[model samples]
Target: MSSLSEIITSSLQKYNDRPAIWVDDCVYTYGDLSYYINQIRNVLHQQLTSPALKGERICIWAYRSIDAYVGILSGVLSGMPYVPLNPRFPDERNLSIINRVRPKAIIVDKNCEDAASKILPTIKFPLLVFFPSYTQKPKWCSLIKQHQFFSQEELISYPLASISNLEVGSVVNTDSSDMLYILFTSGSTGEPKGVVVSHGNVFSYVNGINTISDCHYDDRYLQHIDLTFDLSAHDMYCSWCSGASLYVTPHNLILFPNRFISEYKINKCMLVPSTAGVIQGHNLLFPNSMPSLKYTFFCGEPLTGSVVNGWQKSAPSSIIYNVYGPTEATIAFTYYKCTGDSVDRCLPIGKPLINQQVIITSSSETAADEIGEILLGGSQVALGYWENEKMTDEKFYSHSGKRWYKTGDLGKLDPNSQDIIFLGRSDRQIKVRGFRVELGEIESVIRKIAKTYFVAVLGDSDSEYENVLGGEGYLNVVALVANSQESKENIIEECKKILPDYMVPSQVIFLKEFPRNSNDKIDYKEITKIYYKNKNSSSISAHNNVI
Candidate 1:
């Protein structure tokens, strides 16, 4: 029932000297966390409220520094939503979010100041740039004349004050409807859609996870996902709620998650199965390599039996669970704990969390089989797409007196086990390297760039280039364009400027004509077969073209 900020403050009071988070070589104690949070809170409250600026939320455009972590908390405590902007994302993509969110103040780390500079002029109103990690003003300060800037030293000199008006408890806002964060995911057309998650939604979701009964102060949790992704919430709250220490894996060690898990002796670890697939591709999933782990959870992508078995053996002492959920339903609301013996290629998603509900939309009550589009319901369901009434109304609807989100994923209930089994997306949406992406989004970009409507982008495993290209054993985004005059090289080159790295197509195949179905629509399955057949006959090494 408590907000994360309140839980964190309680931990600060109780476990003052205990390590709260390990960022690279630095271990930030709860005491250190308190000091930093105070400095940020003081500056934030002073600059935004004192000046009487009209702003909705705080935008955190930061790298994985201690400052970023403290900034997010300070914003939450102040009853303002925090929108995270990743430095890895393209300038165009990040700029779009900046233009849309129009946050009151932006918290930035030293590493992200340059990216911040590019978007400063875009802010239409008065804004504050709180540089917690910078001792001196950044070089880009002079370029942006409208906004006020504060260095780390400047904020430290401010008086100590509480943002929530509570000494050490999380009261985000008097209104339960106040938002905690707004996460943007891939859109069906082209742009990314913001998913507004309220403080109540996050708090309720965290409370629902209490039945797991494994997280504790002594256990060390490893953060393997990016802050931009919702999965990061699980890594943060699950540990903080239990007074457990969270170890933030450095970017250099992110790709080598298995090694990071082993080196740090991470007891509880959660990651996308794609990460495990990468580790397995490098032949690093050796038996007993991670015996210190007590739990291993995978989400964001389908968890295959091979990855499940490989991880179980690697972390012999750990219990592995395959988690499934769209970002709209908090981090995840359903999970299937793995048994050592699993023959199914793709593991079942299992059952709902303590407070969550899952239903097969297309199945009737008296049906012989329970199989259809899976819908998720409970406190975990997100508010809706931010300011997107049309989409919200379309996807979120009242069912049996409770709000439920249309997952778009097809699933079936296992009659014997009564667990939900994933049967892939009913639509063209797919996860590429742990990133939820829309095929039409990529196609839309290509259509606009190439000036043609005959563009089809899909994630295919048998792209006939896996053996040739150094793929990390996951679905690759491939584009099939029909007789477009624009060169494949040029179209993808332009797409890189607008789309994020993950959304960009890795390979482009030009077709003489797209095979049409009965309705003359682009035959996706036929086009894929044609692509594989063409690639097989050519025997061309796709290394030069694979992005």
Candidate 2:
């Protein structure tokens, strides 16, 4: 198969009539999936007449719904890259991404139709709204009079009624290197950058080692992450490649995933470390709680030893893996399976997956374990950031005749076992709820809003000298400002309007002046101590602050 669509199409022959996706207690079969994809392609053909639509981009705004998957896969199958926009995002963030991508089309589910309508004036192109057949007319339908609408019943029965094996191969022609999807992540420059991943990039991930070795056709996979996150690619594609049924968790059930796993009998699971952290917080670590699970993979953030041990006891049958990679690499490219023994409190991110390479540079051969910036080179590496050649050239470089992604992550090699032990980042970037966040970006927003020369945002990590930095809540965005007369509530509210919820600071600390080190730089450590000193009497209430 040249593209992911071909691989999915080939599975239809063998997994026909088998449950391919389970959403909201409803099972959709492989045959139904094929039918929907073909119908979507046909709808595109009828609606989009321009030949330029071949490699155009379509923005999909929705949560986890069956139609959402259809919209994404349909765009890929039709040779267009899909840009997934979370409808829950703040209007400013959404508008920023929309302006950057400049997509040719927009697709929205009922849940996000209203949000889509809000941005319609900003978007001059055509919009396609998809709603379930049984759904009532949306309250915003009359208000959104400027877009095209498709009900599940209207298009499900028309156009290509059946997708034959031959038709599948001919429906859409796409090259292996063609752009598949553009995922916009927080950038250091204050604007989100779209990471352009090709069809081959994700194909290598689904077909590569560790992933294929751990999953099988009969395994039921869980989809818990939002589609906007590239981690969702691993959940959706890996499950589809194995011809396994993908059980999607509703947003409301996100906090209680153990129930979703139990109800769906999910056997193969992929999770971000924060989600695992949340699971640990809930104390649902009873033995056999995840009895059906065979494999559990963690990525997108550091996996602590405590969480691994707790999960191991709960899912005794499952093999827990600590995988690592940046979005620049397709989903992930490294894997480390957890054993009881470890040199530190955190698990080491083991070795590279098949067809991938990792090296720690700027160290001596004797001190092979010396910590340095980690570099990844392999087929799994992405083409580059979309339309930002300057930034792409800076990150993606050629070395030793191979393309390499300069992973800004600092790590070292364990000389004894050759496992890659991840230290903290070399820069100010941090992962919050599995999303890559640039502290500088938040500081940039705060600086613009507060009109201050001194602004610092620190993540919670014990290694940092700041006492305020020692807990999971440290990942909560906090802004420390100097010479800002704006009320904390007022500053946070302004940030909430301009930034996404994830980027918005959970708390703002107003300081008369910042403490400085002997070198004259702002001393964050001392400021952390000062905050705690005043925390008892002057800090804002937790309930009054936005989390």
Candidate 3:
């Protein structure tokens, strides 16, 4: 058996009677999760004619759904790389991903049937569609001729499998170097970049996290992040590695998860700092309100001191940790365990995990306090971008026979403590409510929508909502336009159809002419300055619902 699959099977057997996961009212024990995973795998073997499923890609329609978890494991146990397709994404974005991956099969639940139906026709491959949540054959099956569809009937008919009885020859042949999953992140070059993470990368991460993290069988973890996000992957594996129960907050509840976390007695939660910012903004956190919480993990965005203060007070018993890493390096490599008190607005990201190594270009650990771009290297680092050799070569490089990935984030090591302190991005990309957004992609979409040549999208990272807009760390995408006949409302509506809601501008600013640098390039700094100068000027701005 592959090392990754063995780790999973061993956990299932060891924690047979323990609660493993919860999605809404659906609770699964370790044994139940095992049976469901086996059922899905059996269905796949029987339905798909392809005998060699190893290394094949299986797209999982995921969002805190049972089918998502089961499908992901079925792929892992069956030697298939699982790709997550979030239905909440714009159809265009979802379709683009499908076109790029051309997955061997797609696993989705009843909730995702409508979206699957819409995307099925465009899929050129003979894709197998598994609907473990559907009671019967999908109604859209006959309407779509390109893919094969299976219902829960197939899954129920399959025999259950155990660790010892699992077919070793047919499945579980994944090499440590084999791709475990491909996660798509926003790219500055208009297309989303597919980051390929190997089974070894994930295994190394899970092993490293287990060493320092205090998660245990008694701990109940909150899977508050989206399945589409890389942090969700970390939460799932880390919880399982420790034999802990994972309580998944439905995607609908992630925006405001206080009630669910309190109700479930979730002792551990993985949150983006922006989510904490919004929660604090709404005055939902009272002192010792979440005493049941034992560990509060912050990632995806900067964990500010103010946000940490509020969360620490609310979940006073919880240990707060601020983690840092790009999608290119499997979930995270660096984590800072927060103390009782914080003085800086932005807290330190701290040291790297045991299996990982980081380097700040033009700086060193011996340096008093030198700032530079953070570069990552080690077992946790992902293979590279999928199907894009040019980009792969550009981003990943070798130094002294060790591979290194440029993180693009600007940072420095604290002179005194030597902990890595995160400054900010060195590129156009910014975290809009914890979701990565490329300002250039948003601009490209706007240019296409408005049929205008001159359009620039600036990330308003220091907006009022940097702390809260009743949403996750909300960076308002401000669209600055010079030539466009389309009304701001029309442009906003069109953007919603093509781009993710976060990428859509909360406000549109019309400029007669763009400020240019000496090189005659658009001066984003000057435009941002102009934006702050006219922050409240209605004559130059059109506002959308920020939240």
Candidate 4:
């Protein structure tokens, strides 16, 4: 059996009667969860005739409910890899994914029939849509007469005793290097890429976290991340493996985090930087709230200096950690505890996690203090991007008998503390005239001077440049999005004092809020789309000449 299933099965034996899941007002014990999982496993076995179904991929479409958790566990016990599709995805994208993965079957909630029916015509495989007895039936289900759908009561009536008799091994064997899940990344440029994570990779990460955080069976995890994102894996598997209780918050209560955390009694939680920013923004609302919150981790985007300061001020007693990793690295490979001193500047992403190694590599060999691309070599690195060998080969490479995933992020090692200080992305570094410029650096300076809520620096590539350069035609552009009333004049004045002529932003556009992607990160592609659309229509031109 794979380590994942073994861990869960062992936990169930120890904590059989303990409350395993709490969603809304419903509570499910470990015994109940185990029974439901076995029942669903029996249903899958009865429905499929092929002996090779053990390794086949299955797709699950459901909301954040106890039934969804049972469905995931059933997939694991039945030796099948599972993929979770968010209910919020549009019909076109959902259909595209179904066509791409070609899963043998799809398990969906009956409440989503209206949205599901829009994409049902595109799905060619068999399906088992589920309807819980607790919720009201959707009106659209009455129209679908051809497809097979099951209700909670009817499904439970099937003999689960037969399922208990069948021998079920783990979905992931030790030697089998197959993908356990395919999480689709938010596609800003075009179609999203499916990040394939193997069982070994996930196990390595979970084990590391367990050791570092001292996670135990008594830990009560508050799940805030969506199941589609990799961060959710920490809450799902970590809690399940340790025999801990998991509380899934309703989607509506997510934005108003104070209420969600208080009502759910969330002791431990993970959040994106954007959500953290909002929570910290309203610090006065919950001055004494988060007493039960023992561990809080933030990722999914860079945590700015201002945001960190706010969190520290609000949740003074909680242990705040800043974790860094891409989706390709199984959520996080390195983490930094936000000490009182780390807030003075940008917090350093501390040393690598267990079984992980990070190296700063430049064009030429250099000392430890040199700045370069942060290359990650570890057990947590994913297999590769699914089905795109050319793009996969470019990013994933072998070095020194170890496979390294080249993180496009730039960083420099601190000489005194030996921690990694994050710089901006290498691709984001632009050359204006003859001077090299880092947009993040400029944004940092502007943030300090303007004291804005958020800031984003965008390069305008299509600007006209005729006589700005000395006989050379260099385009003039600008930075956009700063949040403050004094931002326009304050940013210009600050830049003139500290920055050279070429480094100063040619234009600064203030806005109420910046556009963000589904993952809660800044949507640069959408910003570019808006920039071009507005540039063509506007007549007022502001260009800084660099000699």
On lDDT, the candidate that comes out on top is: 3
Candidate 4 lDDT, tens digit per residue, 1-547?
A: 3477677777766788998888767888888887777666666677764345666667777778776787777766566777787666555556767777777656666445566767765455666555544243355556666455666665677665453344333232333255667877633223556777877787888888876786877777888777777888888888988889898878787666656666666777887665655455444335546566677787655555556656555556668777877777888888887753443345677778888988888623357777899989978888887777776798898878767898787888887787787775666544333223456666666777777746666554333322111111123436665456665766786666655454567777765567789999877777666666666666323212110
lDDT of 3: 0.79
Residue pairs with backbone atoms closer than 3 Å in model 1 (clashes) = 6-170
Which pairs clash in model 3? 274-473
lDDT of 1 by residue, 59-124 (tens): 888867887788777777777788988888887888888778878888888677777777787776
Those runs of model 4 whose alpha carbons end farther than 4 Å from true positions after fitting are 49-51, 132-147, 159-176, 187-189, 363-365, 428-547
What are the root-mean-square deviations of the candidates from the true structure over C-alphas? Answer: 3.4, 4.1, 3.4, 12.0
Error of 4 at 18 (Å): 0.9
- The global C-alpha lDDT for each of the candidates, from Candidate 1 onward, is 0.78, 0.75, 0.79, 0.66
- Clashes per prediction? 1, 1, 1, 0
Error of 2 at 516 (Å): 3.8
| Candidates, ranked, lDDT | 3, 1, 2, 4
TM of each candidate vs. truth = 0.93, 0.90, 0.93, 0.75
| Segments in model 2 whose C-alpha atoms lie over 4 Å from true places | 49-51, 127-147, 153-166, 209-212, 340-344, 460-475, 517-521, 525-547
Model 2 C-alpha lDDT per residue in residues 110-192, reported as the tens digit of each score: 67766766776556655655553324445555565656666667566546523441255554667778889999888887878
Show the colliding residue pairs in model 4. Answer: none
Relative to the true structure, candidate 1 reaches a TM of 0.93
After superposing candidate 3 on the true structure, give the runs of residues whose Cα lies further than 4 Å from its correct spot: 46-51, 158-171, 364-367, 461-464, 467-473, 536-547
